[model samples]
Target: MLVRCSLLLPLLVWLAPAQGALERVDDFALLDQHGEFHQLSRYRHMRALAVMAYSADCPAMAEMAAGFEDLGHTLSDRDIAFLFIDTQGLDRGQLRGLELELPILDDGGRLVSAALEFGQAGEVALLFPERLSLFYQGAAGAGFEQTLDAVLAAEVTNSIADSIRAPLEAGCPLEFPVRETMLAEAPDYAGEVAPRIIENCGMCHRRGGVGPFALDSHLMLLGWSPMIREVLLNKRMPPMQVDPHIGHSRDAQYIAAEDLQVLVNWIDAGAPGPAGEADPLLALAEAPAPGWQLGEPDYIVQAPRQDIPPVGVLDYTYEETELGLGEEKWVRALQYLPGDQSVLHHLMSFVTGEGEDFWGAERRQENSTRRFLDGYAPGQDLLREFQPGTGVRIRPGEKLSMQFHYVTNGQSTSDATRIGLYFYDEPPEREIFTDAVSTRFLLPPNVPEFPLRASRRLERDAVLTGVRARMNFRGKKMKFAYQAPGEPLREIFSVPAYNYGWQPYYRLDEPIAIPAGATLHVIGAFDNSISNPNNPNPDAELRFGVESWEEMFTGYFTYHHAH
Candidate 1:
């Protein structure tokens, strides 16, 4: 026998006829399965927005799915944005298995479900976003068709649609059993919630850290609760996260489900701070400063001061500093020190030609053929040490060029970032080289998933020490594989869920060996449709380019050629 939680009693009691003026539905945002952010306000240009609360387990969904798809077809010509939101904690794997025509959005914590007051699975809510009012909230059968028709014709204006209450549909309750249980005993903030933040977010969210704001106090956290909640539930925080089932990395930051629930539940519970409780986060803020993890360096070089304006986009700041090396040098490890973490998007250094300074196509003719030394981005390991005998070589006269990508943080500031290098007493037996495995492809406008491929054949035996995928907002996923002499191709590293915000070098725990003649292949795709939230202009045909808004397909391989 099917059972339902009793929490639906109060929810049903509050349900009322949609005959009078309806309250404006608050603006909300959620990421679809395709990783595109869909905010209700962004779709105001549409005639109307149809949001359906969906679940796979409900038997009624089978009956309603075809109706929802049909409604989408009918309204597509009318400029109505149709979306299905998944309230259940469904992962990408489960979502992929479901037969869903409409893009399925993952609302991990049911935050949107609670906000919209979803009564049951397969409930359809029609909203007139321009007027900021709920047009109709009920079943999608006859009443939805009527409202959609009326809204499409001149019958129902934005104001008139608010007063039409569609009849309710019978369906299984969308149970949020945890909310009821949490109500009995609220999650303790200091004991349970704060510790999660400290463990998962403290590394970069503390004072002098890269995070835009500090999360070191109860008051501070409560103030930023809304933004924090959004990023966490959307899986944006603790960047460099991967699908654990696909691959594993020692540096990957995977937050436990229970820990995430504790924080989100605490925020949902109003973020109350008990009286007389000492703040652990505040105490952590006073702990001793974290010195260099690799100790004092052999040499340090700082870039020129980069003036950042109060607003507007700034082109990449390029500066060149001569290493003044008398002889060849071997750098075992190096670390970057960003002058201003808030605005520094990333810093890239290269061993460039004598006059080739910057790293964009617009800057120099030789920018595409330069040597990549190292780079630093948020959450990436800055102080990277090479294997026992392998190190990055520095030619005697090779100059270092720094390209700074600074994002505006709503404030004017300047930066003089520095790089610390530790050299070995003697050159290592093997030297590491960084090269890109990429191909050129055009992405048509409004295309959802366009496949692209790039490969390189090993000229000499080498160990693939690490790999980093490079793509702008439209990049979907990148996988690295190698086909050995007589063996089937095997996957080495895969960024199945690529995020433009965080691009970290995924170092292999055990480097894989590739003999000469083995081919290393890179596979990925691009999402250049309305579904890609990060795509700047889905209507614009995009080709490979250096600008952030443009698109590119490149996979960087870090390997040491065998002697």
Candidate 2:
């Protein structure tokens, strides 16, 4: 059975439809089995988007898939994209076992299924991207083709295609345990829903946080439930989240499938909120502000004051603050205290020589090693303590260069961000440096995924402590992998769905060991197509550059040579 969510249905910026009665469906995105991103809204160029809930284990899957392929071939010339959604959780390799031509959207367990209320395999869904609504959803047969035909019939009217149909019960029943539990008893806001929000989302969605708005109270959740549901279904929130199955990163946390089910199902259940004495989310809101996570600093350096306007686009701000060090300093740990959390999007620091700036060696070469102190991104651990006996060495005459990126929050404010550096009582064992695997290429205009690769062979043994992906608006996803001499390749960290907005330096939960002669690799691609939401201009051919407007594919490898 498929559940319908009609009450308190929030509409997101609906323009009058050009054709057909507007049957509205909110926009969402998902990755196919091939690691390709597919967003429904971006398919406006297509006449129709054909999709079906697929289960490889289902008995009727073969016949239905064959018919779907036939129908796709029939509409080969027409602008129609046919895809399949995996009702059963299938990894890329398992999906490849099916050997299908069409991309199977690998829905992370049951998030998309719960969103569309799909409980059966082989259920069909035809969507009109222009109207942002479903044209048809049912079993794939005569009725399915008829619905699609009437949709593409070029002004021939049929009321059947416009109305929503209850999902047919012919195919195998896909079990959504979470949805079933919710149907039995709605998730209590205070007991289940709000606690999950406080755990996974509170850090970023609170007061003075980087999120667009605060999710402070029960009323707030009610207000933004639709947007929350949309982002959850599309895997947009929990910013800078990497693919959990591929690699492990201390900085990345993909909310558990059960947690996602609770939130989305709660939203589907009208995001009901009843007072239970104290709201957990409100507790997060009323809690003390972000203070020095690593306690007081031995030394503090402040960046220049930044004046942010109420609302508009802002460029990166660069400032250099001389440490004026009387003696050499070894920084074992550090943290950044942003003056205005709402506006200060990100700040990066580097230990450079007298006249150098934030670019360091990035501007001069495709690959180089330098003293990159650290970077600050939203929803990340503020305190960074280096590995035992390792420190970033700063000479007496060195200065700290910082790059500031601020986003306006509809309010005028000023920020004087400060860095707290914790030093070692005695000199550390080894100095830390960041090796970059970067490349320069001319990305073709309007290409969705322009493949790029960069690698460096290690001449000496080293331990990689952290990594950061540096790409501009068009950055899609970058992976950090290594192959030591004859050993098989191992992926340590990956920013699988890289977002330009949240650029966190991923600290590996387990540091990777690289012996001499090991080759490190950075494999990634840029999304210059219209599908990329952050792309400023998909029409322009782009090149590698230092500025944020241009594109750069550099994966920073923070490491220290093994003793």
Candidate 3:
């Protein structure tokens, strides 16, 4: 069973880099209640190693017994090794009554417990022994199931497990008698921890922002410490995390190792605030400016105020306004000013003809004209500007159709968002255009990797400015490529991992020039299996549809004619 024990450990040494936030568990051995030597090295061949920190005296441990038992059966069938380590200093007499059928290793010295640093009962750490790294360290809950599914997927695909997957443990705190002696210094909230939170969390977590709640004071942070810790450890708070090894984007949100340690350490050390100290979070300047970042808009189109109910589903709202352009106008840039940013989910604007609703007379206007002018969503507030010699054209008497998608927050509110456009005196040398490479495919149920492809041949010499991908929950990965005649296809951009919630338009650093006959290709795959944590139903056969619940495969491309 341990044939490659020596070779694998040394080969997987580079899996966990020295500077990462990953807290690797040291290998140790212990005798189970049955006097069977359960060693860590002996389980390297398994898909994963699940270690449950159990305490016979803790009531929380007893409450989690059913969950642990269910997980043991599920993991064993999936080829995952599971075991329990007793952290409490309970004697055999006290444990005999519990009658846990699972293998319970006695950690009389609390050596294994201290090494994993699980503070509470019912916490489990998922380890990938093949890589000699910790895949997930968190409490047993719904989040644990999601993490386990992700681990299993990674195992099947032979992909690297996410380094940060520790959800906050929810259980009675274990009284590690030696822990009190180990904490000699308390982390000051104002001096050490506040700066870190303000830098990383304060932007979205402030009042009237997109965050669910505020973290503007020491008291507020303390009150929400458990949630904050959970999001931070699980790598869920700082959204749209890009794999550092794959590529780097300015929009990527990643927490540094040193900063993460400061927050986690302070929370673990009892979240102390110095006596009579001023709140740093309150003292910090507000991040969002009252006015536009690009000074003032050349022309601002104010959208009609929308009344959002406290609850229930809401349909898409459509509004139109006449631009009344006497002559052609060249728009250089555009920005969205959302009145109630919290309730606003997304906004899509299109330049259509007179009396046109969402779609033109044909009812599918997107196919008729390159009408999708701009879009706005959370964390996608960057000012959209065309290339130096390119701009979007607005003809005389053209109307702007606005489509709003709002999500209720259990409160009655309204939004009057304004679309700001900056125009140039003269038309640019080239006119920018937006096109999409899309396809419709019926997805079979429980298919892990369903490949799809779509391509469009260019009609004119153009420069590819940017690319963006759109898909529903089943979307896994997408890449954009172009093939010139008599030349090999070359991938220009790739979204290795696609999260439905985060769809940012990635701008190319260097624009690619393509001839009129070049074919642009968009290729991707979908995961409709049970392993997909986001899949609404693994058994439901999905088809191409316009609703969010349904599936769609489209890759948006922004380009301009090379006049």
Per-model TM values vs. the true structure? 0.76, 0.88, 0.63
Ranking by lDDT: 2, 1, 3
lDDT value, residue 164 of candidate 3: 42
| Candidate of highest TM-score | 2
**Which of candidates 2 and 3 reaches a greater lDDT?**
2
lDDT of 3 by residue, 343-372 (tens): 777777778776666544323322223656
Tens-digit per-residue lDDT, 8-89, candidate 1? 2222222332233445665665667754555665465566889888888888787787789887987787878899989788
Candidate order by decreasing TM-score? 2, 1, 3
Error of 1 at 427 (Å): 3.8
436: Cα error in model 3, Å: 0.9
Better of 1 and 2 by TM-score: 2
lDDT of each: 0.72, 0.80, 0.69
Higher-lDDT candidate among 1 and 2? Answer: 2
Error of 2 at 296 (Å): 3.3
Q: What pairs collide in candidate 2?
A: none
